[model samples]
Target: MLRVAVDRDGGVTLDDVADATREIDRVLEESDVMGELPFTLEVTSRGVDRPLTLPRHWRRNEDRLVKITLVEGGEVTGRIVASTEESATLDVDGDTREVLYADVAKALVQIEFNRKKKQNDSEDA
Candidate 1:
């Protein structure tokens, strides 16, 4: 079994996955890279559980909530406002904080099921 993770700035869509799968399949079929071995190809997007280790990962996750564990032994949860090659600016509890990528041991995107609902509710009122 093979897994392919497709990622983008906004997010990965069904079309994106389909296109990538098709292209990869075409390439493999043309090259016979598997050498007659039966295998399965699975194309997917980067999951929320995936850790943010690269500058591009942080940049692509802008406006999303994340929980970061510092190398020094502490954790911080916030929404990513902006990111650069060296660091990320996050909005934590209405305050903006900058955290260096080197200082981050691990960072994972947080899932919010009702965040949009809450925003819409506030807008309606």
Candidate 2:
């Protein structure tokens, strides 16, 4: 199976996915890269649970909660406040901490469900 991941700022649209699929199909058909190999081309969006690796990934995930595993073996949970090509600044309990991308071993977006609801309920009191 050949999986293709396409992304854009904000998000990608259906047209983008369709166009990518068509382009990929055309390339595969024209080229002998597959060498008559039977393959399934699957184009899909990047999953929220995907690990953050590139600077673009970090930038796209700004304002989202993420659990970062440091190369030194410690883990940190924070919201991505800002990101640059070399590093990202995370807001950990209102304190901003800068983490270099090279120091990050793994980073995954944390899914939040009721946190917003709880926060709003407290504000209404």
Candidate 3:
């Protein structure tokens, strides 16, 4: 069995994995290869935490909050200040600015919306 997930841009989320698994299943069904190999396939997005280096990645996440980890071990959290195919700039620590993507090792969108209510509820409780 193979499962597939389509992204906002209509990109194949896990096409390679799904396709390969399906092909193996087909061959096993047809030829009885390796005494009936059982297989399962799942395809899905990288979730909301996908990297934001590609221009398409940033476009899919416009207006969202993101966290960027610099190669130098510094971290910057900001609303995706601005993005391009080449790099992304971040508004960090209020007024501080960082051009992150070019030198970043990792970048992920932060789940900020849910955190606010959780914080408020904890305080009220």
In terms of lDDT, which candidate is strongest?
1
Q: Write the per-residue lDDT of candidate 3 for residues 1-125, one digit (tens) a residue.
A: 64655456423445555675577657667775445556564556647866766777865675567877889888777765566677665656566464635688888988865644434456643
Error of 3 at 18 (Å): 18
Local lDDT at 10 for model 3: 28
Candidate 2 at 69: error in angstroms? Answer: 0.8
Off by over 4 Å in 2: 13-41, 115-125
Off by over 4 Å in 3: 9-45, 93-100, 114-125
Alpha-carbon error at 87 in model 2, in Å? Answer: 0.5
Task: Give each prediction's root-mean-square deviation over alpha carbons.
Answer: 3.7, 5.6, 8.0
lDDT (Cα atoms) of all candidates against the true structure: 0.91, 0.88, 0.64
lDDT by residue for model 2 (28-71), tens: 99999988889999998787878999988888888889999999
Clashes of each: 0, 0, 0
List candidate 1 stretches off by more than 4 Å. 117-125
Residue 29 in model 1: shift from native, Å?
A: 2.1
User: Per-residue lDDT for 12 in model 2?
Assistant: 62
In terms of TM-score, the best-performing candidate is 1
Clashing pairs in 1: none
Per-residue lDDT for 79 in model 1?
97
Candidate 1 lDDT score at position 108: 96
